[model samples]
Target: MFAENKLTDDMAEIEAFLVRERAKVLSEAEWKFRMRGYGYNLRRTNGGVEVARLPQNTVLGTLAL
Candidate 1:
C-alpha cells in the first residue's frame, strides 16, 4: 500500500510535519492559558501527555502521542 512506498526519509518528513503541528497546538494552548492568568502554561512533552493549567487543552494533545 501507500505505507510501503513511504521510505524512511519520507517517514521522517512526516514526523517533522507532525511535530511542527503539535508545537502549534502547544503554542495555542499557552496563549489561552496566559490569557486567563500568569504562572500557568500549556505544554506537551514527547510522551504525548499534556499538562496544562487550562485543563481542556489536554484533549487535543492526545494526537501528539
Candidate 2:
C-alpha cells in the first residue's frame, strides 16, 4: 500500500541521516587524531557506539616528531 511505501521511504531517509552523522563524527575524530596528539578508539556498548580517547606515550605522541 501507499502507507507502507511511505514508511519504508521514511526509514531509508532516517538511516541515511544517521549514516551521514556517524561519518561526520568519524571525520572529526580522525582530524583530532592527526592534528592533535590524541589517540582514539570506537567501542560499541549498550547498543550504541562510543568515541574514547586513549592515553599516549610522551615519547611518541605525534607523527611529525
User: Which stretches of candidate 1 lie above 4 Å from their native place?
Assistant: 1-9, 27-65
TM-score of 1: 0.27
The prediction achieving the highest lDDT against the true structure is 1
After best superposition, candidate 2 residue 9: deviation in angstroms? 7.8
Q: How well is each residue in 1-65 modelled by candidate 2, as lDDT tens digits?
A: 01222422243443343344456555745644442332334444564544333453222111110
Q: Provide the global lDDT of candidate 2 against the true structure.
A: 0.36
Residue-wise C-alpha lDDT for candidate 1, range 1-65, written one tens digit per residue: 01123433243443454455446555666543432352223355677544332323322223255
- Per-model root-mean-square deviation over C-alphas: 11.8, 16.0
Give the 10-residue window scoring lowest on summed lDDT in candidate 1: 1-10
Q: Any runs in candidate 2 off by more than 4 Å, and if so which?
A: 1-9, 27-65
What TM-score do all the candidates reach, one by one? 0.27, 0.27
